[model samples]
Target: MGNFTKWLGAGLGFTLGGPIGAIIGYAIGSVIDSGVSVQEYKSEQDDYKRKTKKRPKVKSSTSGDFEISLLVLASIVIKSDGNIDQRELDFVRSHFIELYGKERANRAFKLFNGVIKNEVSTRQVCIQIREHMSHSSRLQLIHFLFGIAKADEVVTASEEEVIRKIAGYLYINDRDYGSIKAMFYNEADAAYKILEIEKDASIDEIKKAYRRMAKKFHPDRLQDIGEEHLNAAKEKFQSIQNAYEKLKEERNF
Candidate 1:
């Protein structure tokens, strides 16, 4: 078997079933071709199903599950604007390489090429993810999607619409969605939005909002997910800090 097939077989968990599973199964079939036997893939699914049936409830997402879900969503967002830019594709590829070494990133891109061909049902995929992933992880997923959308330096209307739908389906409230979305834009109120506050709020309210946002976007909350995600969380946490600092300077507090 090929390295990508081996990694796919071992890494996936809850993503081995549901809409996400079906999408990934199709991608695997398309990409691996003769590298992986049908029985071997089915056996892995059966093993996962049996293990899940024995458990009390569905567990939080595994890193493998997160990786595949990210790829799937990235494909959806990349196609949303009707025209796929190479820079956006490069961003996804390089981001993966940075997060998971060159070898694993190459394997991921092979699977991603297959995924990009399929038309995904964004709502179903997001629902499946919402049911399994933690809130913090879901937040991180939104942050990453916005990064993908803005990779070309301009987020198209279509791309923003698709991502907004995804956030809603994933059960991310407006405040949280706006906060992550604002991180990619340079509007006058961007800092206030990132902190989830109004511009006319008192200095005390701004301080309170900063503390709340800082806690919500804290890197430690994602420590259990993985080091790669923890690093991403740090970027998000820093954004909150920068927003707070900006507001503080503006208010002279």
Candidate 2:
């Protein structure tokens, strides 16, 4: 298991760079096969599956599997505050059904229930997700997780904390997470509001507000505040970019 983890960590670093890395890792692992026929390997795998209490097949990508698992963990954290509400469940269900088939979506819910009952460490689960998924896909998966967390029209500090911690584990930097958070908070709406315009705001209004925020939060300008605040300023600048895009799309401006 230690060796496997080491290899998995290297594989994750490789995978973060590009698709070619993932392909190469798969090829290398396939070539280094431990002298077992495909049929024999399947038989042994099945035996291991039958013997182990954990879901054996989950480690493989059965399409949207990693994403579903993330949502499951996020739901567990969100519901830790109280009972899982119907609104929260419905939000999760809609996202899953869109990503995976209904059957798999239900399985995801059940699997999440089982995992939470066992008190699985979300960090470890996120590591598995990183192992099986590409960097971009993981970002999108985290976005969906945050979306569901905010879907009840509110985000508790606990839920936000869960999302932020998972984002860090997933290699989503503070900058990117801020963009995602802005998207959730309808900062696009704020952008339009800043411009005294709507989704149909003119290109001139868009440019004007962008220029104003850019100057206010630019890293160079924020340097006087210190490095920590400078870094935060960078993240805020990115949120401005996201907000502009959202409003631009909404207005086709």
Query: Which candidate ranks first by lDDT, i.e. highest?
Result: 1
Q: Judged by lDDT against the true structure, how good is candidate 1?
A: 0.84
- In the range 1-253, model 1's lDDT, one tens digit per residue, is 2444457757776787788777876775655446668776565445544543543444677888889999999999999988989999999999899888898888888789879989899999999999888888899999999999888999999999999999999999999999999999999999999999988989999989999999898888876467877777889899999999998888898
Clashing pairs in 2: 199-251
Model 1 — TM-score against the truth?
Answer: 0.90
Model 2 lDDT-worst window of ten:
1-10
lDDT of each: 0.84, 0.52
Cα lDDT tens digits for candidate 2, 99-139:
45576566445434433344445666566666665554565
In candidate 1, list every pair of residues with a backbone clash: none
